[model samples]
Target chain A: MGVRVQEGDFDLAVELADFGRGAGGIVTFTGVARNNDAGNLQYMEIEHYPAMTQSAIEAIANEARSRWDLCDLLIIHRHGRLAPGARIMMVATASAHRADAFAAAEFLMDYLKSRAPFWKKEVTSDSAEWVAAKEADEKALDRW
Target chain B: MIDVVYFAWVRERIGLPRESVETDATTVAELIDELSKREERYALAFSDRGAIRAAVDQTLVDLDAPLKGAREVAFFPPMTGG
Candidate 1:
């Protein structure tokens, strides 16, 4: 298990391959930046309460582990300013079977999106706005 | 004693991000009540109690859950994490 909050990008393919180890399956989910109708988003500034963020993430990871027979997992979420098209976060899971791997990866992502402490401030061409919690995000958690 | 933290709009309403308080409460609800009585700012910050979510020692916890042995408690809006 690993949680990274940084400005650098990640290589999901390499991450998945490494996580696979001797496992039979690996599933990875990558969340990318998207252009919103609000305008051209120059960048997104992410803020998080350090201790709380880590604890929340670890709790999610623990839940994932308990639900799946996984070999390893990786969660990398970036903080600070990020331009459009940049990677926002990635979750990868490896397991002895495809079903467990797939479900676990999705579960981790869903929980991370809804439960983590990080918040985003979108910097549009005209002005900056704090991204509110989307209803869809809360709904995503119900799938688990 | 616990270190309670507020973030984003919660902090904006409460007027501070961090504070230390000693309490005899065992659950988050009691703590919230105590905090809401502190000042108008806290009252406004905790006005819509349902809109706020909490974490004990950084783990997401139900408001009615016991806070025994917790070192930190945090209140904020529903997470918008990615």
Candidate 2:
């Protein structure tokens, strides 16, 4: 289990088939592209620094492994155009106990939300806007 | 020559993705100040320093981060990834 950044969609079942072979508990989280409140969304365009994406994710994974007793961890994030309901990314963590898995998963999510270089721009029928980073997201990092 | 890059709306406003600049600025802030004086586009894109984030050689850093030995620097909006 490692990190992957690509434009192709991933299969969750296929991804987990051989994941965390010896772990007692595995926790997984998937983020989906959501429709806007107005419900007139077309797609989301995700942009990332190609040279930094992989290493940045690897650093986050290493931090998670350092802070938890993990067996395996996987992070798969997609870039390019994604429509509503399409999966944007996934994080999976395996540990001897469920608590560690859950905590590490959350930690990874919190860090990725702000530290990663990816940006999302939502496109509607007639307008496009970059999604602003929430104040809550930066604050979420303080708890860990 | 310092390789400077931009992403998302920063790139859109700057009208390009990356460039190399020869400069003697000692900090990221000074570098931004240098670029900001180059054109109205640079000034507009960097108008709000609080809304912009800087990275030195692919590692995120403060605006005051030194540029003495930096080869690459990137400026972009706050990340909204998950």
Candidate 3:
């Protein structure tokens, strides 16, 4: 159960090959890069705080474990340039019950969305812009 | 000297990703003020305080957060990570 910040894509099957030996349920979430509304996306450039990223993710992962009863967890996020349809990140949670696994996965998602030290910028054929954080994303944390 | 880093649009507007600054400021707000006075670029990047977020020594904090003993400070817009 850990966090990894990388520049390369991850293989889910290989990552879970030896995962969750005795857990009753395991849940996983994968985020994919999508094209702009005009369907002219070139690629996305992800910028991250190199010095703080891993530790920041680990802190949130630890918070998830503290809040939920889980057997294991895995969070992997990628940086750098990524093409559309490429995987951006993945989260997996294992627990003795399905509820814990599902809840933990959601919690990790909510926390990482606004709290993590990473940013995404969308580039199209003629222009590029940073993806603004939605107000709802910040408000989502209030539910916890 | 404290290492100040910028990300995303802040990096773009400031025209640099990172720099080291010798400062006597005691808080993040003061640091921003110092940087803003240096050039119009810095002023433009920091024009909207509400849209910016700061981290001192890798931990997120409010603008009033003390800069004492901090070796690094990062400024960026709200994170949009998944």
Candidate 4:
């Protein structure tokens, strides 16, 4: 029902407080910034296509809603620098059936991983580099 | 003239966020070709077509995608969002 691309962090508790009413099942997935090994990781910078990011996510959320009888759905992605352990983004789906909720959640995640316009640049003590997109993530869509 | 924007490493390589281009290019491919001939940065950023993704206006489109009447174009690396 909502899609947000922002610089600020989101509180799951606050986000879910008024979420998914009257649903038999709800599934939530949160992506956190994890330190790359060699652990000198300082912070990660996220860049996004400002004009396309929100619409792209909303389109995916709509697709998820269509594929499942979702009561509600939400996608929130954070931009800007984030420290290790900071919550980066989250997706939540609600449906009358557990299977529907679960399936849609996975669908959204799979598509979001590769299709959205955000990019991650990892910063360590010595250097920073744009995270190379993974082929596996693109292949994950074939299963759908 | 079309507003051409760059993002991610493409922006870093090109050293600017966007530019205005007046062109007769009819497709994204033609536009890239035009830009590639502009300077080393443009050429380097666009040397490999496989590494670049583009959008017309704000919608993602293929390089062969038409640019007729489009006011904006954007280029960047393949999306790594999640």
| CAPRI-style docking class of model 4 based on DockQ | high
- For all the predictions, what are the DockQ values? 0.71, 0.91, 0.93, 0.84
Candidate 4 lDDT score relative to the true structure = 0.92
TM-scores of the models, in the given order? 0.86, 0.99, 0.98, 0.98
User: What is candidate 1's lDDT per residue for B1-82, written digit by digit as tens?
Assistant: 7999988788878888899999988899999999999899999989998788998887888899899999999998887777
On a 0 to 1 DockQ scale, where is model 4? Answer: 0.84
Best by DockQ: 3
User: Backbone clashes in each candidate structure, one number apiece?
Assistant: 0, 0, 0, 0
Q: Give model 3 RMSD, 1 decimal.
A: 0.7
Collision pairs in model 2: none
Docking class of 1: medium
Find the 10 residues in a row with the least total lDDT in model 1 chain A: A12-21
- Model 1 CA deviation exceeding 4 Å by range: B22-26
* lDDT: the better of candidates 1 and 3: 3
Candidate 4 lDDT, B1-82, residue by residue in tens:
9999999999999999988999999999999999999999999999989989998988889999999999989999988877
lDDT score for residue A113 of model 4: 84
TM-score of 4: 0.98
lDDT of 4 by residue, A1-144 (tens): 899999999999999998899999999999999999888789999999888898889889988888899999999999999999999999999989999999999999998888888889999888999998888987999999
Of candidate 2 chain A, the 10-residue stretch with the lowest lDDT total is A50-59
Looking at model 2, give its docking quality level: high
Per-residue error (Å), model 2, residue A86: 0.6
